[model samples]
Target: MGSRLRIVLGQLNLLVGDVPGNAAKIISNALRARDELKAHVVVFPELALTGYPPEDLLLRPDLTVRVELALGEMLREISGIDVIVGYPKRQYGKLFNAASLLRDGKVAATYFKHRLPNYGVFDEKRYFVEGTNPCVIDLQGVPTGITLCEDVWEQGPVEQAQNAGAKLMINLNASPFHKNKGKERFDVVARRARANGVPIVYLNLVGGQDELVFDGDSFVVDGRGEMTQRTPAFVEGLYLVEVDADGQVTPITGPIMPELSEEESVYTALVLGVRDYIGKNGFAGAVIGLSGGIDSALTLCLAVDAIGASRVEAVMMPSQYTAAMSLEDARFQATTLGVKYSFIPIDPMFESFLGALKEEFKGMEPDTTEENIQARIRGTLLMAISNKTRKMVLTTGNKSEMSVGYATLYGDMAGGFAAIKDVPKTLVYRLAEYRNKIKPVIPRRVFERPPSAELAPDQQDTDSLPPYSVLDPILERYVELDQSTDDIIAAGFDEAIVRRVLRMVERNEYKRRQAAPGVRITPRAFGRDRRYPITSGYGAETKNEPGGNGPAGGI
Candidate 1:
């Protein structure tokens, strides 16, 4: 009748559609927590069974059947301590996002999520039928409340639990990372705990799930509304905490520290994102094009840091126009990072494209079309290598290039994953500098040399676009800030440049849509968080015409 209850928060990274593998991982972590940490209970994040936001996969009955089978096996495998894990459950011909409370190899309690968030990359309502009841379970003689991700975000579930006479509320979540979202999470948990007069444990999933990267900044709040235990964001591990009858919780003495700054946090997030994406999918390794530019260098460093140097390969595809210093720096960086390096001269392919189009465009001057052709040829070679070696190709285009239509559609954008597709050009430089500060793997010329596509002879980025110092700030306001063209122009930028940049972004919709999924580090990312219609008329400075008129825009 007398027992001290210890709960382990399993902030694990689950692969989408990998039900059995995910179940095995959950059971292993639970055993470690129960045996090694001597914890009485373990709770994993929402949708840990089939992974978070299964997206269109939920429509598949076979996937659900597999999940159900996996859950049954997981229940049978789990022993000793109680377990609270999330999974998709179908009851009476309806699908529900439910969590099972397991003990002695049986489901003690099951709670379906009440609030189905449908906004901003979430379409839960469309897929799940809501559960209207509250679930309260007896944990070591004290009643504990249970809720899913969005359930605890609002006050209804928390209040219902408190009214149900529960002393502790545990929330399982798969919350995606966004700038300033960690603080917002703390605020919500503290407010809910203080208002409900009960201790709360907020657990989130970690690692990347396609375009979404869950930060896993799990924490525990006391009844008095103080955060007692906080797990690091963007990493995977078990965070153990002890909750008392008085509703006071404290972090277990171990090796978990708070994540540093937004940039550092995001950088680590990208590393974990890439690692999980490659590892979970069972890729032998990853291949990236080393353009001797900042974006590729940063991505190479991240890939090496994620899966080690031996697992990362860098290829230098230089055209006749490629700078000698750029090639030197590319070789230097490849050697410095100790990754597999190769050089494939793109001049032959470039000439082929030019010859193929020579009859059609004999009088027209060589332009970006020709440059894109060269890029496409390089892309073809990289993809061929990727197909031959079974290694995933990592595209190195930054958010800036992606934003302003600066990237080619099937050319540089052809890859299994775009490691930094959400990172801005300016941040690309910053991360490169930060990486160099550690071991100086990237050559000085990589940073010092002008950024270029090197498709045509002596082609600098500044030839067709503004400097990153200028372009990145404009893009921040337009993409992240969600400012309209007029708003951006009013934010202290040249109207002409804003208009041109906005036009480029609008015209590049088809390209961005075709690009691979990448790590999302900012408040708004390119893939999911930032959504725009391809057939639209709104853009940067077009709002204010000569008479100050244009089409209205919406986020």
Candidate 2:
């Protein structure tokens, strides 16, 4: 038996449904792990061959064929090094999330995922049937068990593997990012390792997929439930671990990457999400409507960081009510970030729109309709620029406004992607501060001034909504925590304000449904994570009932 056994954890960023491309990457990484690292085995993240959560793409009839071809290609090309990779396997007319162990250019063992996660952004149960068996393989006299993502989250798989006489466990994952999610993962893995008395290697996928951003904080934990080795978050690399002939794993003596602060982690997630979405979809660049507000400032900073200053464009569309300070700050930000800047005053467009709508508004008094026209004009200009330049328009609405329907649907909400849609307004200011610490991009006055849509004369956001500091906590409880109106009131909030906020959130379902997808930094975000019906008759009218209000009110 060999006295030393080395393994490489390949934390890679894979594109969904790109079987050929993903296969080529896997083959290259496998060869590097074997020849370069001089390791015995290389382990890839969950569904590394097909990317993650391929969603409905797994149901395609040709998917099985493509995956098999890719697997066969890897098997034929890779030799000497054993490789463990994740993919979807179809057997007896049913699909399963399975991992393949290859040795000497042939499959040595296959392990199917036992637990199918169905809650929170996951719909695995919809596509895959549960796998009920344990797979243990022998490599250099060490008995190793294999498990996929959610399998280690439960007690059955690890216990089953331990009972099957496995001494070491390797768990593959494609876990998505949310606040403090890394700590949650570590807690679960440590408990499982100590409970089963087995050393565990936890490997995770990295990169962005639509609204999901996977932070590759992979690590190895010993039987004593201590983290021995850890890779940094939001990075892609090959990490190494060693074990002896007696099946004892060595503790990593090198530096364990420090955990990122809440603000830093969220900012990084937004950057990665923007980078991957634009890069993966083949956009020329990103165009942002740079209002001299905190939200747009933060969005601009994120875009510059994601794709560099060369690929980002900032447009300032001033209106009749536009303040000089706003214009100055917007230009300062543009100059500071080194992005292309353009100024197109919308006064003429606003006059033209009013000229066309004069007859239609003969007997009507002007209100939000006039303000909406300004926003819509800006939206139209941005979209036209996007169409001409093939650049994606990154919207700047934050979660606080998005929740209470403070956003205009066909106006300010018109864009290809929303960079901060899932970020709350309060967090937006923090992220701005975070970015400025790296370098001063956003002007200081932007944070000091009150937020506004600037559609009407002296218009401030407080005119229609509560202060963000007060509003954001209420929103976190109501939207993300799913607290009831009464529950929130019971928690020391004004009942009238709570009811009003809840009503607005309930009535604005249609708007949010039509909004662009953005990065998810919280536990619950709109789109895939939270599903609400657009047309519903629910209101926040309740008398101390638990499930009183319908979907909107309950949310």
Candidate 3:
């Protein structure tokens, strides 16, 4: 290159299925890079035109036509700077995940994603055929190679590009966020860069689609496997990086955004996930049942931070058994945050339902059925408000509760979005504390008080389940890590508690199936990440040896 190619990294947040809108974004960002940044080239995230994981929308033939038109718009409208953007392409009656390079108003080169990932949330193999060739093109006298997200995760694609005499590589991605996901991506990409001895430009899409949230921690790794530039996570902007013709990525022209702490990163991911889901779905605002517990408290903070307090509504539905402290905290939090707040007692509704069922239950003893009735009363009221006000209801249940069926289906689980469905109970407290550190919105008493559902008089969570300090770890092993009951007991948990927890998890698959989709902060979220049959008899407890202390049957 004459000097060095100043490449703009387009870390953008795109809505799925809006081809024209996404294309307009690609055009605007590309033009800004050329005119404002005075840049030679700009790289957009994978599937920028159609958004990532278009899922079965790729099955629509009209989507392909829309994509072609969008691609034409980018090629015609963006000039003076080369634009390499991703889209789904069709050739010979087969679909491929493709990236195209537009140079001088003509197609210069195109690279199909070689590796089709088919695990966890990705189902690329079902929709795309694997590509076989390596694409290396000359960019302003520099020999550059191209690859997609999963292509860089494995060893073969990078090797193929290097063997083809590529001096630099640009990999586009739509990788989603999970805990420690950034470090994992960095390790894998750095290893590939070092193995191939070529610098790489890593760009990712940032937004939320359903439960999946993409964190754009885009960076550049030098030839020796050192990351020179790292952009901020959960932010969208055009970042700049310089690449030399000598097969080296020079220092970034922009400032390196610092990496976030675990609490901060997860918190920000939840905020972004909530924001995009409401905005993309065109909801007027959000309505959350503020129960004065850790899950709901943290969710209230995230909602206010996400779409702003004006757009969020916190409703306190106090039942006859609801604690006085809970009512105090709920009102305090909503007032402190300045959201549209209201209160509706469920005693009258709960009593009417009970009166209707009294004659039929003459001999039956009152039990959890009554508790569920109260919950359903609250769910009905909040959903009614959501229907009339056009606000989406955000569920407050966490992963620990959902894993073992501590939640009531059609009752507490009734909502459009479950903001903290994938958050563990312990992490909920930590996140609540983290938000308090920023601004003391949640009261300290909410953290210090023993957790309770307050459905029954003096009811505590520990009365029906293990303490969360022990419960969360056992769940992390069994649910998230897929460990057997025996394996968990071997890891130092009590055998009976392990089996009971495992049984709850196995039996509750049906409940999780019906729960609303939420942000996935862990490796194995319930809906999309972990897929277990609800009707299976081979529960985790049965996986023990023939002479073991496993449970006899699932709950």
Highest lDDT: which candidate? 2
Instruction: Score residue 48 of candidate 3 by CA lDDT.
Output: 91
lDDT per residue (tens digit) for residues 90-139 in model 3: 99899999998999888889898999999999999999999999999777
lDDT, model 2, position 25: 95
Instruction: Give candidate 3 regions above 4 Å deviation.
Output: 246-254, 540-555
Q: Is 1 or 2 the stronger prediction by TM-score?
A: 2
How well does model 2 score by local distance difference test? 0.90
State how far residue 511 of model 3 sits from its true place (Å): 0.5
All candidates in order of lDDT, best leading: 2, 3, 1
In model 3, the Cα lDDT at residue 231 comes to 87
Error of 3 at 195 (Å): 1.1
Name the runs in model 1 displaced over 4 angstroms: 1-3, 246-256, 538-555
lDDT of 1 by residue, 1-555 (tens): 224578888989888888889989998998999999898899999999999889879989998889878878877888899999999999989999998899998899999999999877789987899998899998876689999988878879989877887778899998988667888888988988888778888899988877778989898887877888888877689877876554343323433466577667778778888988898788899999998878888999999999999988899998778888888888889998999999999888778777888899988986567777877888899999899998899999888888877787778888999999888888888887877777989888777778888776677889878898999999998888888888988989998888877777776776788889988778788767778887766653453444223211101
What clash count goes with each model? 1, 0, 0
Query: How does each model score on TM-score?
Result: 0.92, 0.96, 0.96
Give the Cα lDDT of each candidate. 0.83, 0.90, 0.89
TM-score of predicted model 3? 0.96
Per-residue lDDT for 169-255 in model 2, tens only?
999999999999999999999999999878889999999999999999998888888988889999998888887655464444434
lDDT of 1 at 155: 70
